[model samples]
Target: MSRTIRALAIVLGLTMLVAGCGSSSGDSASSSASSDGKFTVGFIYVGPKDDFGYNQAAYEASVAMEKAVPGVKVLQAENVPETAESEATMQNMIDKGAKVIFATSYGHYEFAKNMAEKNPGVTFVHQGGLKGDTKLDNLGTYFGTVYEPVYLAGIAAGSVTKSDKLGYVYAFPIPQTLANINAFTLGAQSVKPGIKVITIATGSWCDPSVQSQSVKTLLDQDVDVITQHQDCTKTIIEATEAAGAYSIGYHADASSLAPKGWVTGSEWNWTPLYTDIVKTVKDGTFKGSKYDGDFRVGLQTGDNPFVQSKYGSMVTDDTKALIEKAKKSFEDGGSPFAGPVEDQDGKVIYAKGKQPTYAEVETMKFFVKGVVGKIG
Candidate 1:
């Protein structure tokens, strides 16, 4: 079933039977266990395995992890809801002999923590979630500095936009989403001064209908270029091909989806991250402190967590030069949230020689100037 339909079914008090629910006890002699007899690694996905967005990225990483580690067995449960069923899914994996579990969704935080507490033997890693006051020893959070690459994509969009008006289709109004929007605007403004960005919040993560309608709304407003911070490539494909506008993508390489107007986009190379995590678990170095495994990496690091896809043939040389220069600056510790930043209300949030801390940026609430939308 589609992710949106499954979510609605979950909310409507329906008991959805997941495949492979009552397979084996995971300790069976014929199970797919490594030769070294280590426990299995489990991954819980919030969407389908082929969504070509968030879930696909994680699934691809898991496949890479399996190949990297010899004799390793990786189990996965797709289309898992973020409600109580999340805890149940983890339990099912545990029953099937999974020892290290990764929950790849923000809403799975509480359920993951609960599972960790109940199954102290299992290690839990949550994407885009922190183990706050719960202080769970076996739960940690990890995410990439996606804003860095989004900034570079913004340069491409800025260089190509004819109307100087760009549109962004977003899933929610959280701090993470806001940071990307602000960074994209800042990156565009750095190249094409006074460029305006129009944003639309779909309020749902993977609804193609809502996303398509949002793109239509932006196109009607004369937005010549469109990008997104969403869980699907529907916006990029529909905007560039159907609406005849420039496009940028997220989560994965979507250049194929927008042949006509594909510029460049931010992609997550989760192979390195997943391989490192699995190695740590295999080598007995895995820990579960409140913040033990809280990790963040981007382009500057040797591990290519955040990357810019190959520029489409239509991208200009000037835009490529600008992106390369900005990337070098980021590698040298420069940030998009540097001083002289202003809020949507024209209030100077950062002075001429100041910037926000990492913690502050992670919880950013206000939109930067030059952005046209309310956080609803």
Candidate 2:
């Protein structure tokens, strides 16, 4: 039997070559390798494919792979967690004769790596994994530099917040979440010098109930604009729409969710990475190497996946032009965290006239100058 799950949140936005920033899908029926030479690939996602963001993006990539590469066999099961269930599901793929497996969640990292090692003949690619063990010779990992676009979304939020206060609904407090929050705060401060951002961590990635409450809480306090780093925009978009506030969305395009109040957002284009891996497998040149897809490969490049909706009439053409210029500048060696940074505790982290390096931005851990509340 096969099932579907949606994992991860997809941020949405426009196509500009900015410096920073950054599925599974499920299979319906079991199948064997293709009669032709193409190999069979299996994808495991942590959430439902219909979840409308992370899972959907990965599923879309698998579909695109099928369309682009004739005779390639692809199977998927959605909502498979990183717990014990992953071991069984991954084993099922191996037993079913999957030549390569793509585990598209952070939790699946160790599980997939272990299985890949146990089944040395099968190739595995785990997204967002950092593995130091040499036992996994068949495993590789890849992730995007998403902090770049999050900063850009912050710029939109910063420009649109009339109250100089912004709200964010976070899923977890890991390094990834912290980096995203920092990028957003920096973007807002680019336009409004001391914009205050309030953050609420719902702990779980796909809890609509809790996410909605967090957004509503912020709105009740008169937050004019909202942004989110959760897997779904159900809470952020719903609360913002109910309160008649603007929102910047993540993962996939959510402009339709808040048609009138939508601004730009951040996104990850999985197809470019997916296509490259599929091609590598086909060409027999694939190796177990870690890769970070970003502006260099046009993966997170143009306007196809990321788009800024012209929803708010208040969004000026000048603002759009400024965003374009900022993107260019960042790509041309400008850092998103360019100095005078402060945490939620009012202590200075990066001094004035100092800029963060790529490694520093990638490992970001603190709040910036204008975020209103603590990470918790």
For candidate 2, write residues 129-243 as lDDT tens digits.
6654455556777666567777777888888888988988888787778888888888888888778788888888879888878888998777888888888777679678777
Off by over 4 Å in 2: 1-29, 132-137, 288-313, 346-363
TM-score for every candidate vs. truth?
A: 0.86, 0.82
lDDT of each: 0.80, 0.72
Backbone Cα, N, C clashes tallied per candidate:
1, 33
Pairs with steric clashes in candidate 1: 137-288
Looking at model 1, how many pairs of residues clash?
Answer: 1
lDDT of 1 by residue, 31-59 (tens): 45344576588888877778887888888
Highest TM-score scorer:
1
